[model samples]
Structures are given as structure tokens and as C-alpha cells.
Target: MSLDVGAVSSSKNMGGFDESKEGAEKSGVQEVGDEKQGNVKRNMSDASMYATEDEEEDEEGNKIELGPQYTLKEQLEKDKDDESLRRWKEQLLGSVDISNVGETLEPEVKIISLSILSPDRSDIVLPIPENGKPKGLWFTLKEGCRYSLRFSFQVSNNIVSGLKYTNTVWKTGVKVDSTKEMIGTFSPQQEPYTHEMPEETTPSGFFARGSYSAKSKFLDDDNKCYLEINYTFDIRKDWAAT
Candidate 1:
């Protein structure tokens, strides 16, 4: 048997030609792939730009921009209007009054100290001192002896304007005319104001041997009573028993 060397050489040349053709086809496919990748990149960049532009537009196609000249006062006013509008909407929905929702301003006027003095002009402290008991004016009154009711009080700043105080004496649950109502404006002071009620003008002789009470009411400009204080005292026939 004889081997054909020519046919073998021809087969080797055909194999080389097929290999070169395959390399050329592979090179063309690589160029098409690179072009498609570039097109995809360009499309993605265009999509990103469109998305950025759309973000700046409103529903009506108007561009939105924050004002550079926004002032603090204008911002505060806008916020206040927004709050008012919100409150109005809530009131409409719930049928409630928004003004009376929170705590209102209430004034406080308290009697800090009280004392009685003898005719010799000496300060004599009460038996049950001022503010000693939870409530009441704890003092003893004499029938014939003359004494003075000296008191110091404190007024709080909750009182924007002036207030009127009405002092009244109650004997057996009946209102007696003793002292006139005092009206004055109060200021923040370190020293308290002192008031003296003489025995002649007080309800000493008129009050019998029984339990009596003195009440003071503070009234506002609208005649609304805001604060009230009471002092309960006992009356005796003999001055020695007091």
C-alpha cells in the first residue's frame, strides 16, 4: 500500500484557509459587538439626562426653583398662615373651637402674711399665723378692744392689666358692709403692699359671738373674678379670752 503525500499537503492548506476565514469572521463579530455596546451606553446617557430634566418639571411642565430671596419674616408668616389654615380645617372637620382648646390666663393674688396690733402700736402675731392652715383667717376678735388688721399680699404677673379687690365680711352667712372695694394696678415689686383695717371701720362690734369670715375677690377689667381669698376668725365677749 502507497500513501499520497500530495493529497495530504492539499488537506493541510485547506485547513489553514478555513482557520483564517474563521478568524476573519470572528474579527467582524467583535467589531459589531463593540458598536452595539457603544449604542447602549449612548442610550443610557440620554435616558439619564431626560430623567434629570423631568425631575425639575411640575405636572404642568413648569420648572421648579427655590427662591433665593426668601426672608425669615416671610417664612415665618407663611408658617403661621399654614398653621392657621390647618387649625381651621381641623375645626371644620371636628366642629370644635380651636381658641378655647388650651389653658387660659388666670391671675393669682394671695395673702402672704397677716397680723394684729394693739393700741400701744406693737405687732402681735395671730394665734394661727397666716398661711398656717389650708384655708381660713385664723384670728380672735374682741368686743370692746380696738385692733388693726394688717396684711401683706403678693400679685402674680398673670394679671396683664389692673385688678379690683372687693373685701366683704360675712356674719352668719349674711354679707356685711365693712370695707370698700379697692382698685389698683400691680407691678412686680420686691416689697409687698401693706393694708391696715382699723377697728372702727371693721366688722368687730357688728359681729356677735360667733364664727365670721372675711373674703376678698380679685376682678379683672371684664368684671370676671379670677382670684379669691378667705379668712375665718372667731369673736369673743371678753378681751381677756382673745
Candidate 2:
């Protein structure tokens, strides 16, 4: 018995061997099916990932409370008699005008825009719907591409403590990744705050190209949810057509 060399070469060329696919195959990973290509519909599990974890304290295992929270007016008036301290407070609070603002108002944070940045390509800015609806197919990323998210937001009324961001991703009913990032505390100011997250590389090969659903939230230490977005994106063989 003998094997046909030409047949073996033809088969190898047709299948196209690559390190990613080789590992995926050995681990029982399969290519994304057609059913997984459709847009992910909204469900009850949108905020499930960060729901419980937000209650966890910081890494030092200490929940430090700096006395009671104060309103913007109260903070400004605490040391009004001292000219030097008043100047320092004014500089630290940016250009927020506390005269018209109510005395008991709480801090408010509004997310203005979100943009996706990829090397050698134009940024894809995603619009925030008025009613917080899940905008399906917000953007597409090429497999193995490096990308990052840029966020623009405004704070008003007071200071928001321990601001943070959380993102959870899922594919085909399975949780694929989860990320938690501390954005730091923010004070009310005239200009919006812009933050760009550290870059991340998407998975490659056949099993990695497919539609994914994600839940992203911006919250603070007080458990106040500033913004929560449920969106879907695609990881394709190449960058999507603009």
C-alpha cells in the first residue's frame, strides 16, 4: 500500500495550515457557525457580569470613608475665610460655578461619546442613543488587530469618587472575557474628561472571528451607575467596509 504525494500536497494547500488554527483544532475549538453571525439580541443578562463584583472593595482590602459626603457649595464654603485655601479650592474644582447649582444636588456624570481606535484606520465613533437602547453592530474589528476605546464624559454638581469602568464580552452563550479598570475620581469642571483605555489585541483564526455581545458600565464607589451600554460587535477576517 502507498500514499499519493500529489493528493497530500493538494489537501495541505487547500486547508492552509497556521499556528492559530492548529492550536484551536487540537483544543476542540471549532469555527464559528452561521447561527453565531447574526446580531446578538438583548437579554436579561446584560449587566450580570459587573453586578456582584462592583461590591468588592479595593485591592488593599480596606474600605476607607472620608467622613460624610458634602455638596459642592458646602465644600467650597468650608474654608472660605482663608484666601489661600479658597484659591486652591477654586483651582482644584476647575471652572464649575456653584452659585446657580442647588445646594443638595448630587454628582452627575454624562457619557458624551465612545470611539474605537485602530492602527492605520480612521476612528469609528459610536453614537449614544437617547433612550439607552442596545445598538446592534456598533463596530467591526479585524481578527488579531490591536484596538482601544476612547471615552468622553462630563461631570457636574460635585465630585464623583472612585470612578471605574467594567466590560464583559460573550460569544455564543459563553463568557469570553471580562475587564475592570479604575478611572480615578473626577471633579466637576467646565470641560469634558477624555480617557483612552489601554490597547488590546483581538483573538485570531477561524474560531475567533464572529459576532460578540458586550456589556459596559461606568460606575463609582457609591454604586451609582453613570452609564451602562449593551452593544454588539464583529470580529471579521478583515477590517469592515467604512
Candidate 3:
């Protein structure tokens, strides 16, 4: 089933994309207004936040060590005799039906949809192309307009570690902006997770209004890419006449 969480916002920063203002949720709907405005730049830079190799260095060249991981069933069986622990597990895992899962230890994540919300405009649900190719114009952003993006996805089997989002934009082959947000880990569940990004104001000015190429990616701590999209959008002097 599709979910509607309303319009959200995001900002750009000097580092790249601004850090996420809030955490993701397994369920719920949030409506955001379009009043706030500011210069957004890439914010967070904690390389330790993502899943690294058993031994690997972050951007700062610090070594990170990861231990063994447990599958959903294995985690559920833990402390099976502890009633309190069982109850807590039930609350944390929320609606995960182990009987329906297959014999795989690796977690599976499916990105369902991405919706763009703008003030005084209908939400634009961008299609997730199967081949990761440009189907056509993804969407157009009016110069100086306020908007946010909502991502809907599902995880299954084991737990997904360090799920994150990254976006990079370019104009005339010159890199303009890049963003990275840590979406946190998630347990397998029947209900899809919905994450609404922070609000952001599109760049305004004559030079900012033009066609651009962009790539959006969803990955986990293991650096395993789930979705990679190559698409095009426009920063227009005015909203498209459609």
C-alpha cells in the first residue's frame, strides 16, 4: 500500500546536502509547511555512522571494527525464556512475520516510491525506473521554491544496517552539489518505512535556472547499493505549465 506523509523540506550546504533534521519512522504521517528558508549545506560527516568493513578507515582515517550480525530469527530466539525481553522484541520488531521469510541471511530492501511535496502544489510522485535510466523529465523545481522529498521502502529477512541516502547534482558536466544523510538501521517488517527529508529552498537567480543531471542512491552500511537512479530535472524561472 502507498503512503502519503505530506510535504517535507531539505537544504543544501557547503559540504553537500544538509543533514537530516529528524529520524525515520516505521509508520506515521507528517505534514510540513513551507515558511522556513535558509542557505543549506552538507552537514553531517560522521563516517562511523555507516557500516564499514570489519576493519576499514573512515574519511578521517580512523579504523572501524564491526562484529558478527544476527538474522531476524536468530535475534528473536535470543533470550527466548525472558518474558520481558520477548515483549520488548515484539515492540521493536513490529509486525515482522518470520514464517513468511525465506532461507536467506542477507536482508532485502525494496524502494517503493519517492514523492516531492511543494506548497500550494500537488505532490509529485516520481516513478522509480526499473533500469535506472532516464525515463524522461523527473520533475521541475521553480526557482526559489520550497520543497521536500518523501521516500517509501521495505526491508525483509534480516535487519538492514546503516541505510542511507545520497544525491549528487551537476550542470554542464560541472559538479554543483552533493548530499548524504544517514537513515539509520531497520528491522524486517510488513509495513514499509516512510522518511520525509528536511525542507529546502531551490536556488534562485538566472544562472540557477536551467537543466541539470542528477543521481540518487540508497545504500546500506556494507556499501551495498539498493537503488541508483540517473535522472534529469530543471530549475525553471517558473513552474512548468503542466
Q: State which candidate has the highest lDDT.
A: 3
lDDT per residue (tens digit) for residues 120-190 in model 3:
48888788889987677888888888888877898888767666676766666655555555565666767
In candidate 1, which residue pairs clash?
137-231, 137-232
Deviation in Å, model 2, residue 205 alpha carbon: 1.0
Cα lDDT of model 1 by residue, 76-184, tens digit: 2344658775553333223322233212244355656657765734565654334333255455556555565555555443322233344545555544322222234
For candidate 2, give the lDDT.
0.58
Selected candidate, larger lDDT, 1 vs 3: 3
TM-score for each of the candidates: 0.40, 0.68, 0.71
lDDT value for candidate 1? 0.37
Candidate 3 error regions (>4 Å): 1-65, 79-88
Residue 38 CA error for candidate 1 (Å)?
Answer: 99
For model 2, state the Cα shift of residue 241 in Å.
1.2
Better of 1 and 2 by TM-score: 2
Clashes of 1: 2
